[model samples]
Structure formats: structure tokens, C-alpha cells
Target: MPRRFWGIRRLLRMPVTEAGDQYSIWVGLIYIFNLIVGTGALTLPAAFARAGWGLSTISLVFLAFMSFMNATYVIETMACANAVYKWKRIQSIKRDSVQDHDDHESDEPSRPFNDMEEPLVCGASIPSRYYSLDRRVELGEMANLFLNKTGRTMFYCTLCVYLYGDLSIYSAAVAKSVMDVVCSTIPANMTNVTDWDALPCFNSSSADPEAYTRMGCYRVALVTFAAAIGPFVFFNVQKTKYLQLFTTGMRWLAFTIMISIAIHLLIGSGAQSRPPAFDITGTPTLFGACVYSFMCHHSLPGLISPIRGKSRLGLHIALDYALISVFYLLLAFTGAFAFAHLNDLYTLNFIPTDNDNLFVKIIEYFLTLFPVFTLSTSYPIIAITLRNNLQSLFLDMTRLESYNFFLRKLLFPVVAVAPPLIVTYFLEDIGILIEFTGSYAGTGIQYLIPTFLVLCARRYCTTLLGLGVVNQYKSPFSNIAWAVFVLLWSFICVVLVSVNIIQKKS
Candidate 1:
């Protein structure tokens, strides 16, 4: 019953506005930033080290994969937009027909046909009425209605962007928790270490003279739980326009993030140690990181609406994909070339000691702090999304003003503190957990969702809605081929993660 709650209700009732529409651009930019900076910055170097530094080759493959994925997003966006446009047109026509029928019923009861359907009675359709009255009234009504709807859409879209952004922030928090553990255990140098083969990959290796193995595990578990909260809440919440915006933003953000990660890989300094061919699992930790890096496709659909209007979005998607591929390939090849003979996964074992290297040190420190900032920003958004979802179920729920205050001032800080504190307790080898989660959850959400949505839209919506005629000709088989490509890669991710987990457990 509070004014804020009523405002929410009013938002739901109103249409999207131009001002709201403008926010979409910001949402798009942030989406890109979060995706790039979140986990990609921290994990890509490791992944490259694991891939044996076949950077250019791997980059090409990644680029190709993204290109296919981008194609699907384009198709899905156009299809959904066209469907919405057609639906709106049909509704308008129906409304006009109903109004005409009602007017005729009252004025000329015996008329067999409505005035809207009747042929214009020759010259009787006067210039005064035809040119001014009816046309002006109808146009004005439509203009007003459209403006109102636009405002509502913008509000909902902004809300969705906030929610998705929180998800990205949570990912960053997970990384921070891992880095905290890693930094705490590993020594400044492991130059004298010779028995690298016997080192514990998941715990502290000889590299970490003061390894806190037990502490790291506990921290990993706590951060995992904290990170899980956002997605859990998202799934439980009823889908709204805001939710849609979140989803779309996620997709575009993932694309942009991939590009940024790739760029960093090409230009970023090399790590000092070489990755082992096999860890406990047949694949190296770096490989796991790469797989994880690509796992964020689930968030792409949210961008579909905004990108549907112009072909520019498609071009943007392509460019980003191409760049990411190049970046990854460089990481893979350079990492391998730099340290193929070494047994360690991290290139720079001196990171802990070389605090004087301002650039690397700054990035490392920032990575540690980022999660704190991101988590703080994210918590309130998640709370609000959860609150909105639960409002109907809890009819007598606390007022929005009260809930907002509690969430912002109390719940957020508490939730934020819980992870870092819990992680502080057994904080060694936390990076593995982060890698595993990224590979499993991130890949599923980032790549799989867009691929599936696009394929599904092409298959069902294309034929059902006659989209083929409007767009260029592409066979159903061709569409299915694209889907199969995505499905295959997604399956690889599953296999990669599953095998890694099984190996780790054993």
C-alpha cells in the first residue's frame, strides 16, 4: 500500500517511454562491462595456460563458434519483434471493429454490417470528416497509447537490467573469494620447488609455503552458496518484463565480455609457470577455466528486444565474437609457447612477491576488491526482484517502502558480509571451485541459452508465423544444423565439467 508499491503497480499499468528507452543503451553498455570484467579478467590467463598456448588456433575456433551463436540471436530477435508487432496490429484492428460495431448498434439498429466494414458510401464520405475528424482522433488516440506503453516497457526493461547485472556481480564475488584464498596461501616464490608432479592442484602446492588447505575449502563452499542465491531467486520469481530485460542484457553482456577477455589475453602479460598436461583430471585447470569462461550464454535473451530493431546489433555481435576468438587463441598459443615445458598452471609464480609491478599488482588488487563492490550493488537488486515476485503470494506482505529500506540497509550488507567471512575460514585452493562453477553454470547460461532460444524460435516460430517469407531463405535443415552445433559444444561443456568433478572427487 505504500507509494513505492503503487508506483510499481503504475509502472506495470503504463507503457514504455522514450526516457525509459534511453536507459536501454546504458543497460547495454554495462552489460558489456560486467561480462568482460567480472570473471573473465581473472580466469582467462589460467585457461590459456591450460590450453597449451595454442592461442591463435583456439581463437579461431572460438570466433567461429560465436559467429554461429550470433546468427541465432539475430534470427530470434527479429522473429520475436515481428511477432509482437503483428500481435499489436491485430489488437488495434479488433478494437476499431468493436468500436464501429458498438456505434452502429446504437445509431442504426437494423444495419446488417458495421460502419467500419461498409464501403465508404461514395462522395458521402465528406472531406471535412475524412480529412480531419476521424483521422485526427484515431491518430491522437494511438499516439497517446503508444507513448504510455513505451514508458512502461522502459521501466520494466531497466528493472531487468539491474537484476542481470547483479548476477554478473555475484560471479565477480565468487572470483574474489577464490583470489582471497589463493593470495593467502601461496608464497612469493617457489623457485626451489622440484617435485611439482606431487603438488596438490586443488589445495596448496609446494608453491604455497604457508598453505591453508582446510580454510580454503570452507570459504569456497560459503561463496558458492552466496553466489547461488541470485539465480535461485531468479528462478523462483515469476517472469516479468523486467526479468526479460535482465535476460536480454545478459546475452549481449556475455558477448561483449568474451570480446574483452580475448583482448586482454592477446595484450596481457604472460604468466611465469607452464601448465601441466594433466592435473588430477586429464584436463588441466586452465582448460577448466576456458570452458567456464564460455559458460554464460543463458543471459543473452534479455538483449533480444533491443537488438531486434536494427541490424546493427547483429553486426555488433559478430564483431565481439570475432575479437573474443582472437583473444582466446592468443592466450592459448602464447601460454603454451611461454611455458610448455614447465609443470605449473600459473605463468607468474612471482605475483605474490612482485607487488611492486604496479600494473599487475593493481589488477590483482582490484580483482580482490571488485567482488565487494559488485556484491554490494547486486544484493539490493536481487532483493527487489525477489520482493516483486513474492508480492502477490504474500498479499499482506510488508509495504514496499519498508521492504526496500530493509533490503538496502540491512539485508544487503548482511548477505554481503556472510560470504567473505565464511570464505575466510578454510581459504586455500578456492580457485578450483570458481573454475568449476564458471564452467558449469556460466557456460550453460551464456552459450547454451542463446543457441537454444534461437534454434527453437527458428524451428517453431519461423514456420508457424511465416517468418521465412519475410527474412531471407534459409532451410529448416540449416537452422537445425546451427542448433546441433550449439548443442554439441554445450554437451562438450557438460562432459568437461562432469569429468573434472569426478576426477577431483576421486
Candidate 2:
């Protein structure tokens, strides 16, 4: 065999997981599906209406492909990080062996879930390397390993911004959904209401006129939401198995109700509705919404870390994307055809009408409040993730033990949860939040960061582990040109989104 193929053959002999390192593959898939299909999916129908069906379909398909490719890049870099760590460990063991003058030290077998089948002898020829994905290496730690000081700073900044945007969108959506559902006097018949703010929270309020506006209700709802969900950030909470199951169940129920109802409406009279084929002006917001809809790169590590077997991880993720993409298409198409005017949040389209049957009305309320249920479950987890990252960015891990509990635990969570909530206080528009978050910071998280990590990891791994080592989990799109392409795509998206925002204002 040629020298180039030798490492791959050796690497193929190892197992992807050990006996007790992670959970079953099915659970991992559920968590990923839940994370990827959240508030972003809720906004897709409105984006679809604005951009038109044909153009939206093409853009969505392409964006999903790019998102999946970036996901693979992150996975590949995780394996590289593992490889680097393992190599350093082995070298440390070798030096220790020399100091102790023990010949038997180098003869020990490699541990499971570590680098597989590493050379046992000191001063021997470097063998082909195979990095396992059994252990979880986070994107931040990967950045520390593969990126310089400036690169690490930029990575954390981009990640923090995207996560803050995520929390902001979640906060605003949940509050708006709750306020809309709970307020009876906000006009049940929304046909004549051009602006959401035009409706008053109550029929009559002479005590304080400003307090009667919908904006006041929204602020109250926002505060109530914060009071209810904010405490979860201060504690350590994991997404347990039952929580995943429950979230998945609620998500499916909500989607079924929305799609079935829309289909029924379309069959009756909505078939005559004519939507635009293509609208260039709407494409900028559409681009942002599509990118937002497919965002899972930032949370991939935690979700992918617990899978028991990962030899076919890429295949499994592809299937998840396929299912999600199909479901998104169904929801968007049904919605765009079923209603002449779509709400920014698609769930709001299902608000109960006065004439609705009792059972139908209950279902309508449930669908309308779907964002609250789904986003409520997610907000704490994202807040906690951001809090931990903030600590990593600010606190020195070497002196972590010296810090008091208040500074270490309480401050970061408050820091993470406060900014976005404050942001909601000033701006409650979900469309603007999604557009800026998904288009700018989201572009960096999804495209540029992953590209840079993989490129750096590949270089660092090759230098450390020798040229013959191979990473089994390497992305199929492994060419340097792919990295270049992703970078170029990110640049172009940022430029276009910025230009569109400017034109809209002018």
C-alpha cells in the first residue's frame, strides 16, 4: 500500500466509542432536533411570504447544505483537538518514563476513548494517528488549542454575540406570545389591525393612558417571563432524558396542529390566495431568517458529545437536517397559502377567533402559545451556556479556586441573562432581532469560526502527530478550497445583509 493510505487503514481498526462514555444515538438526535428547530422556525412562514416560495425554497436548501457542512467541520476539529491532547499526554508519559528509568512504562496499552493504538515504546518511529470523538471537546477549548490569542478572543466575541441574540429573540418571542394570548381586549379580530401597537391592552383606561398600550402589556409580560425563567440560570440544570422527550413531544404536537389547520383552511378557500413568485427586496431578511433557521453549530458539541457510537455521525446528522428541512417546507408552504397576511411569528396566526368551536379554540390557544413552551425550555440552557463561556472568556482558570462563590457562580449568570433581557426592554421586534443576530454574528458562528478552527486544527495536528496520522471523523469536504469557499461565502453574506439594511433605511 502507498504511504498516504496507511494511516487511514490503521485508524479504521478503532472503535468510535467505549462502553460507558456517552448515551444512545437516538437521544442525541432528539436534543439536536430540538435545538435546531426553535424560534427561528417560528419566523419562517413570514419570511417565506415576503421572499416568495420559489426563491425561499432555493435559498433554504442551499443554506441548510452550508450549515450541515459547517457542522462537519466542527466535528472534524473536535477529533483533531483530541488527537493533539492525546499526543501531548503520550509525550509526557514518555518523559516521565525516562525520569523513573522504568523500561516497562512504555509497554502499557492505550486506554479506551483515548487515542487508539498509539506506539508503546519510547524513541520509536511515529505511527499513524487516529483521533476518537468519544470525549467531548468544546468549541472554546478547541479555539484555545487551535487558535492564537486574538483568534480566541474573536471566536468568543462572535459566539457570545450570537448567543445573546438567541436569548433576546427567545425572550421577546415568549413574552409577545404570552401577551397576545392572555390579553382579551387586544381585538380578537385582527383583520383591521395594521399595527400591533395600535390595539390597547384594555377597553378603557383613564388612569394612565400609556399603561394601556400593548407595549405596556408586552413589557409586563417580559418582566413576568424573566421572573419565572431567570432563576434557572443561577442553578446547574442539565437537559435530562425526560426533558428532551417532553420537549420533542410538545414540538411535534404544535407543528401538527399548525400544519393540519393550515391545510384545512387552504382546502376551503385559501387555494385562491396568490403569493409572489420572487421578491428581491425581501431576500435580505429572508437570507437572515434562513440562516437562523438552520443554526446548530454553536451547540453541536454538547449535543454530539453524548452519542455512544459516532462512526456514522455525519450520516445521522444529515438525516436530521433532511427531516427538518422537509418539515420546514411543509410549514412554510401551508402557511403562505393559507393566509393572506402572515404574522412575524407564525404561531400568532392561530389565535382563536370568536366563532371558533370550543375544542378548536383550545387548540388555537395551544398553538398560539407554542413559542412560549418551546422557547421557555430552551432559554435557560442557552443562558447557562453563555454564562459558562463568559466565565471562560473573563476568569483565569488557573486561579479559579481563589475566587469566591458569588463572583464565580452568581455574577456570570446575571451577566449573561441581564444584557439580552435589557435588550428586550428597548426593542421587542422579533424580525429585527432575528435579522441582525442570524445574519451578522450568526454568519461568523456558522461559517467563519468553523472554517478557521478546522484549518488551524489540521495544520497543528499534522505538525504534532506527523504526516501519516489520520482523523477518522474528518469532514468529507476536507479540501482547503472548501475552507476558502466557506470564508468567501461568509464575507458575501455579511456584505449583502449590511447593504440591504442600509437600503431599507434610506
Model-by-model lDDT, in order?
A: 0.41, 0.79
Report the Cα lDDT for residue 42, model 1. Answer: 39
- Residue-by-residue lDDT tens digits, candidate 1, 114-154: 23321212232221111110001111121122224553343
Per-residue C-alpha lDDT of model 2 across residues 313-345, encoded as one tens digit per residue: 999999999999999999999998898888877
- Which window of 10 residues has the lowest lDDT sum in candidate 1? 128-137
TM-score of each: 0.51, 0.83
Q: Give candidate 2 misplaced runs (Cα > 4 Å).
A: 1-21, 102-117, 120-130, 185-200, 204-220, 231-240, 395-410, 425-433
Best by lDDT: 2
TM match of model 2 to true structure: 0.83
